[model samples]
Target: MGSNYHINNVNGPAIFGDNGRMEINNGTDAATLLRLADQLVERMRVESPALVPQAQVIQGELAQDGRPADRGRIRAALETIGIGVAAGSGGLALAQEIGRVLGL
Candidate 1:
């Protein structure tokens, strides 16, 4: 089943086959996809505004002292999400985990 598919409590005759499979083609579900994308964007928008300045400051300080936190992991993760790939259930889980961590 595709990530966006919603199965409800509707008992109906079989449509596809005895065992069915669902595919999300070309991400045509614009409204739902946009909603999910917006959620991700919002998270970044909130987290990023503060982080970018801090990152730059820390990076500069570390360069001056010859010690830097390797931020490649964070940069790669951001790039991965920027290229239209849905983060899937893992993203949702991470978001929930963040909420729990912050006591939201």
Candidate 2:
């Protein structure tokens, strides 16, 4: 029941089991996932311009001060951009790396 984030080779972002398989879960902590989504957006802007717009949309939703009603939109956007977020401990190292890179 662990989760991990992954940037798929195609069809955009996705979430899967931590055991290196593609198994979807319910969801993860929005705050933390949104932060990672933000980082992914920035990275995509530099690495993959085509995904920037979608990523921006997700970022904007996450940035909203309310209850983040656009979680589904955010997930869809990430999926469209070949990114995924999972819930579990396996991604801690990658998350740390992202934080360091993004200076979060």
Question: Each candidate's lDDT (Cα)?
Answer: 0.37, 0.53
Clashing pairs in 2: 3-87, 12-81, 12-82, 12-83, 13-82, 13-83, 14-83, 14-84
Looking at candidate 2, the ten consecutive residues that score lowest on lDDT are 95-104
Model 2 CA deviation exceeding 4 Å by range: 1-31, 83-104
After superposition, candidate 1 runs with Cα above 4 Å error: 1-28, 49-79, 82-104
lDDT of 1: 0.37
- lDDT for 24 in candidate 1 is 21
TM-score of 1: 0.25
Tens digits of per-residue lDDT for model 1, 1-104: 65554365333443232136322232233344334434544554455443334333322332433543233443434344333233454444433332222222
Whole-structure CA lDDT of model 2: 0.53
